[model samples]
Target: MTADSEISEQPIEPATDVRPVDSEVVLARGHLHPAILLLRLLDAMRQSVVTVVAGLALGLPWLLAIAAGMFLLQLGYALARYLTLEYRLTATELRVREGLLHRQERRIPLDRIQDLGFESTILRRALGLTVVLVETASGSGVEARLDALSRSHADHLREVLLEARREIVAAQQAEDDAITGPGTADASAADNSTATASTAADEPEWLVHRSTSKELFLRGLTDLRLSAFVVTGFALFEMADYLGFLTQMSGVARGVRDWFAQFDPVVLGLLLLVLLLVVISFGVITGTVGNLVQFHGFQLTLRGSVLHRRFGLLTTRQKTLPRDRIQRVTIEQPWLRRATGYGVVKADSAGGSRAQGEDTAGGWDVVVPLTRLENAFALLPALLPGLEREHLPWQRGSRRLVMRTTIVGVLIGLAGAAALWSTAGSLALLALLTIPIWALLGILAFRNLAYALGDRFLALQHGIVGRYIAYLPTAKIQSVVVRQSPVEQLLGLAELTVHVAGGSPTRLPDLTIENALELRGELARIAAIAAARDWQTRANATATRPPADRVGESQLDPAAPPAGDRRPWTEPRGDGPAADEDHDRPGGAPPDSSRPL
Candidate 1:
């Protein structure tokens, strides 16, 4: 063991150093809770169960020895980690140090932290421990994890970290105002005063949303997908095969099939229908139960600029996200949910993996899991200030888009009929019956597709059977592009795509070429302005910091447009809109102007 580990494992001693009143000081310092050792060992055992069982069954002494050796190594590593890992909270940053041979340390600035999340499984909960996850704007997943900290310590650490981050941000904002002149000082002062008053009063967080049992059940019911049941059935079969029960299960299935064959054809059809119903019912019940376990006691609250979310039954989770980090808010309405007047609200921030499947499993990114459609829209302003769904001046695409879509659908119908002609002969004529349905779908798609450019947000709404409305902050937009396929070019139609951090690009398809070009230029200009403002803010903040801690200008604003590239939007590309074209044209007119929120 290293000297650091030796000292850390010993009992705590009183500090002897005297520090100045205004100097940086350590707020908290400690190793993970002792329960982590047992937790790690349990995890190791769980993972090795299959190997151990196989070894014993096969009477392979060497395999058993290998498993035993691996278990011991894991146990030793866990013990070393428990003894050496130390986390320290300083005034400006959180420092974590570990390792005995290759000593390493990680220092994360409090202001850069995006969220602090806590999770506890049944075992950890039983031990009064929780896992702390630290996230940052690194475009990665969790940046740091402190597994199995005492619940009280974890909660206390969260409060301290958030308070420190707020103070740092306020200080930076004040410094920026000082550097930029007196124009923003009054607003800064007012914000500071509000924060101070809230802190002084120890005000309780304002409850934003809560999920009841009925709501959770409805959420699960509306969220049902046939794909999930199909996947589950396949997983069950795989597990049965792994456990050496596949042969017996197959024999039982064959016997049931034989019995069903003995019944009348009409009765067999009815029996099959009943079986399908039973399967559907079982899927619904399982889905509801899973939802209940995942989202029980769900609640969301706002404390100043931070949003707090708490939920779950068997594995509870508590997460905090700052409002400023959010890049976009998406409101989703599946066909069933739309029919039931329900919708889901999700928010993507500046960092973390963009895995929607994982998000659903862990309830990540979801601001409001399930709520009434109107209520879901109502919650938008809470996340992004000044956003009002009813006030948006939504713009629809050209009518030609509908016609183009209908043509494509009809073509597809013809193709399908041609492919089936040889196999089904005259019966293939039934494929033409789908043409009307496709045309109706195209019309619905046209009606649902719309885009709105507000002062601070760019909103896009689209979908046919299911609907999605995405509100992306103009300041967070990273890139804008206009794309046209050969068919679209022939039809004078184009697609505009806007990219943002930590999420997939949002596309506004089936737009007229003129409108697409105009929108792309406007969005690009907005992104450049946002980047310039961010650079100024960062420069001011850097000026206030000590020279030794300062970063380069390029590092301060990596998103800034290249020098002399500011007017790329105004420049003409080959075969695209001309730079000298009149802006007053119907489709080329700029969007309505609105004051910044």
Candidate 2:
């Protein structure tokens, strides 16, 4: 039977209170809005348009038939999916069931939910529909997507889910306190604030940041890169060739060259310079227009624990990221942006993947896309409550790091010179000129390579022409490794890599071996404590569940101590090297090798 036939015609009403009285009772259950079918059909048509055009141009009847068949198949599948799909919201989990020939079901625990985002294309908006995306800590990016729901229903669902999650977390925290006495004063204060926030009839939202047209223009102006110009030139050339305009362009080029041939050398050089300037101007204008469209009417607001971002002109997007889910926040000041005193702030949450290009158009991780340097730093405290930009105790790497980088840069310059020797002959000597530039870059890099470890955060600063400062919460660190390459070992230096949930691992290169080990151990200890606290909360929550539903205590967390073990979580597990012991062998280590701790 179709979901529409089985379910009532009336939509599920929003819950007055999402707090759990019974775990198994359904809070809401409904099928996707009927408009989903139209959206799906439109998508199918869009996909087939190219095929249909190609078939018509090639005068191939069979190709048209194939395209028609594909369209029909897609329409049939969409119909089947719409008819079978149903979602249920319980106190403990959000359940989705769908399928016809093959049955499928998904049960996402309320506590694991990290984010709920809304998106609407021009078509969807006109139809009063929205797409809801659900994310978890599963690391596969979006875990579930509910397409084309009524806007009101989508908002109601988001509210229900977030409220339910908050209730669950609060209950877990109370249970934790019963066992562990009490948490830190800051945690207690946060819990109180959360409680106060939840008691309100409506969660008040405050506008945190808004991008003006001027800021958007500057963002695009400074977003320039040589790669963008090269790509644009290549694309234009290919298009000209494909459209049979290359010959015309070549004739024009020949005419211009012949005209220039009659001019003096200095005049030709000046003309060439003007042409280059014009090309650059064109690129910058194009880029600026693109950004203006993409970020028009951008706004960021804070509602309770979640940050809500809304932007885009043609396709409006609304992204909700919980402050607690943010694993890392990076402030980027590229050369041009730095020169303009502007910077961009991006965040990595446990809900999304970095491979998805979180900073690109249509992605949701940019907290502050563009702002003045001081303003950008000032906004961090709002996103990360306890962060103090000026108070961080930054520490630079050893001077050996500078020497090592300089040597590597010089070697690269020499290699380039050697590679060009045969082609450019005497002109190859110009390659050696890069050595001074490389040396300067090395010095700049060393100056930028600094890290600060705070009680609750780890801040890393690095880069040469640009500056990047990443702030990572200690509780979010999954693993810490100290790695020593052969050259690093010779220099008595090592690199530290800290792994978090959703983004690339953060690296601090060129630290003394002793320092690397010390930092690794400290981070590991902090992670262990966090893991233990998480375990206690989970265990307590599981205790209230039925025996069959409860998770196995020993399997709760690999990094956590086993259930009923009374040992302090901060103590070493004795599975690795001692803190005071030497990491190297009795003699010198082998060359061109590496090891991870």
Candidate 3:
């Protein structure tokens, strides 16, 4: 941060004109309990049991009887393990405090935590476990869980987190004041605010920000990522298959069975058909089922001006991820999602949890996960007053890619199908099946191709879903790219990749050359104006091109002066030339390394 920016940071204070404040308490929290680990292992093992039972359900009567016996044995072991497991909680941090004889304790301080997300699957809810995730950027993080704890205990832990944070903040402010001459009340308030874990709880109630359900849903829908969706879907399908629904499904597919039986075909042929059907079934079931359960029963509630959500089926999960954590926010519309008027929304939070985070850490950085479609823009003003959704700069070209790819793919598939038909009669069906596959691929390629959402925060709305919103404060971003690969060049397009902190990148593809270039220039100019770090400004101002004879940094902008004589990346100069090459390192054209967003 620049000296001016630092100076500009005024002392912050909340007016005391309103109502009396609630009592601040120093609550004690327990260490991570051991029962939590046992519970997790139990859940995992339960999944295995479910697999066996499902398999047995599809087997012959005698096999089913055997499976029942095996299930009983396994269940007995699980019950024993659960009863023997040991876990406890403490006031300052969770003390895993497990094991019958030899024990281990992992301590995670609440003060260092950046996130306190909660999780409860349908079964976990029934079992009464609100999986507590104590998240931090530092590798020293903890999952302080209290499985099957009564509601009172869960509430108590949350209260303890607040207390710990308040204590830490108050202590920090006291220390800083001693060193900095006790600047302003506002500054103290700001310090205290951040120290409290969330802006909502720390700052005065009126000063807190809130986002509605519509806004929350939009955020969730926009962050949807195709890779995540694909992976999650596949995993769900595999699990479902392990449940042996397919075998039962096959039994009901009597027409198919009868058709094969009549043909007197080789057993291999019957197996191949069933396999193909299973794969298709997996995809369809996974995609549809995953979406339904995740997006179901989603609701956004605001308390004391803080936007929070309560979601999940069997076990309800509630979260109050602060808006300030969001560095960038985006909304997206895939063809299918768009057709349904659903727009997914996401935000980038530096050093925060991931949306829908895994159970172990940073439960979910995302504020809204799998929100409904119709309202992406309704919630922007909560953080950014004027931000609005903008269409992808290169959306139209998706149609072209979709049509062309579909045709080519179909042709290749037809050719392959023809070749295989003579060797294996079932292969002839490929000609018919390939069309849907190619078309779907085309849809994905097309739908996933375009991207948009750039404003003050540098938002990029990409991905199909499970969506991702990689947020970074503009100041945290290192650089922005507008480059054209040969493919893009041929297609008169360029891809815009926004560089961010933590190496999480966001890409906007198939943008028109003109649009991409405009964005590049606009961002470059913004980089200069918005930079609060003096050193960064100076480096950018004096950045020099590489030498004419070299491909290094020296040749980048020869028109400028030597880089050695130039100031750092953020120093502003009133009289310096547009750029100075005097300080150039004769060889390197490396730009000032902006902190990766």
Instruction: Give residue 106's error in model 1 in angstroms.
Output: 0.7
Best candidate according to TM-score: 1
Off by over 4 Å in 3: 1-104, 121-129, 137-148, 181-296, 301-307, 348-374, 383-455, 459-473, 489-492, 502-504, 511-518, 521-597
lDDT of each residue in 219-287, candidate 3, tens digit only: 343333445456665765575355444345665655545554565547745655566556555655664
1-597 per-residue lDDT for model 1 (tens digits): 243353345443232122224435988888999989988898889877778999999999888888888899899899988999999988788999998777899988765565678889988999999999886633455778898799999888878877776676566546555644553333333334333322421444666778888888898888766465677666654653453443346877667556755788899657545655676778788888899899899988765545678999999988766555678889888778877878888988765434313455887888887987656655566576434322345677766777677677777778889999999998987887777877787777777777877667788878787778888878778899999887688799999999986677889999999999999988998887665444333333342221111111112121332111212223222221322431211112112111101
Q: In model 2, which range of ten residues has the least summed lDDT?
A: 585-594
- Stretches > 4 Å off in candidate 2: 1-27, 90-93, 109-115, 136-141, 159-201, 226-272, 353-359, 389-391, 422-424, 542-597
Let me know the TM-score candidate 1 reaches against the reference structure.
0.77
Ranking by TM-score: 1, 2, 3
Per-candidate TM-score against the hidden true structure: 0.77, 0.76, 0.52
Q: Cα deviation of 401 in candidate 1 (Å)?
A: 3.3
Decide which is better by TM-score, 2 or 3: 2
Question: Candidate 2 residues 237-307, lDDT tens each?
Answer: 56535534433468876665566568898986576556566778887898798888788788887765557
Report the Cα lDDT for residue 324, model 2: 60
TM-score of candidate 2 against the unseen true structure: 0.76
